[model samples]
Target: MRFKPHFEKIRFIFGAIVVVTISGCFQIFGSGPATFIKKSFNPSKTKQAILFWKGGNATSGNSLQVSIKGAGDDLDKAEVGNVFTVDDDHGKARLNPKAIRLIWKSDRQLNIEYDVNLRTFIQLKRFNDDTIVYRTFKPVIPANHMD
Candidate 1:
């Protein structure tokens, strides 16, 4: 009777809902913890040093923090705004609006790194790929430290 039609309709809607719900859950919780890989820099003809922290471990709920250190000169006084570039391996450098901190540590070399969620970096729309590239001008180390 008419009961068959009603049952079919209900089943279709239920199936659709289940499919959508599962897909959403995968998008939300599928990605696991973020893994940060350290990149090494070589002092060569390149005045600016570029390092990238892979975003495989990045999720959709955290902010990307860029920390700079080992600059013998106070970065606050230097033109540091346009100093670095973050790309996605596709030739795009995105900027993070979060606070950038400059600290002076007695380290042998300059190191800069950041932790950012995939969602935050994706908002920039600068990268069509998944990886995020960070490029910065060579940290101004003391001449005495130069090899």
Candidate 2:
């Protein structure tokens, strides 16, 4: 499945919940006739555990191979303690910073904080083995930025 970048970038859109269940009903008769039947598929046959990466909806196993572009505009996966460059080059000066300390807030959420002469921010989702699966990146400001 292809993932399209979100307008706001990598935001989880928890939309309506659609449950699809398929079960059958059986009828039984007493003294007049004997109708013995077995019924299965009672519980929901569909898996409802779903995740969204850049507007692409996938189940737990459906997005096992998903990928996304990093803040450096390079498509990569975020693992623990991984550092990468996000330096910027202006006409006069250049700012070099590294994105590090990849932490998984949850099984499906990740928070990556970086720097560039100042601290920056990036967030993504993890599908399998804590791999980032969403795109769209910008400098994430902290609670205080004047320091």
Candidate 3:
């Protein structure tokens, strides 16, 4: 059966609305769901580091994030952190989830260790009066071959 002109226009508009609505949902929810990994507090219990992984789409890999905030602040509310990404192979990320670690070496220092190969997006050396120390067990390699 053939569709009437007005009916075809209505169907097209409805399809457009559905596409926009779904895309809006994705934007509201971010790339994908985030999973909490670990948290560590300084010796003085004043600041804390929260670790999490955020899923990514086909073009981008999963992300490992470490946020530093006041000890009492909520993890979701923490705004300052470092972000690292790894290749996304189909649905799997090229990172070993267990290879990441966070430790408080001192009241003013936070130690972060992850796979040396992951690409770092944001690396904050200092936050407020605290210092963030990042390290990988093995020698480091540049993220981009430009080096």
lDDT by residue (84-125, candidate 1, tens digit) is: 323332312232322122221222233333323122332221
**Residue 131 of model 2: what lDDT?**
44
Residues 1-147, model 2: lDDT tens digits: 245666334443322111112111111111112111111111232111211111111221111111222322322222111222222222111222222223344444444443333221223344334444333234455323454
Candidate 3 lDDT score relative to the true structure: 0.68
Worst 10 residues of 2 by lDDT: 55-64
The best candidate by TM-score is 3
Top model number, lDDT = 3
TM-scores vs. true structure, each candidate: 0.30, 0.20, 0.66
Cα RMSD, each candidate: 15.3, 25.9, 6.7
lDDT (10s digit) by residue, model 3, range 67-117: 777899775632324433333233232344455678899998888887655
TM-score, cand. 2 vs. native:
0.20
Lowest summed lDDT window (length 10), candidate 3: 84-93
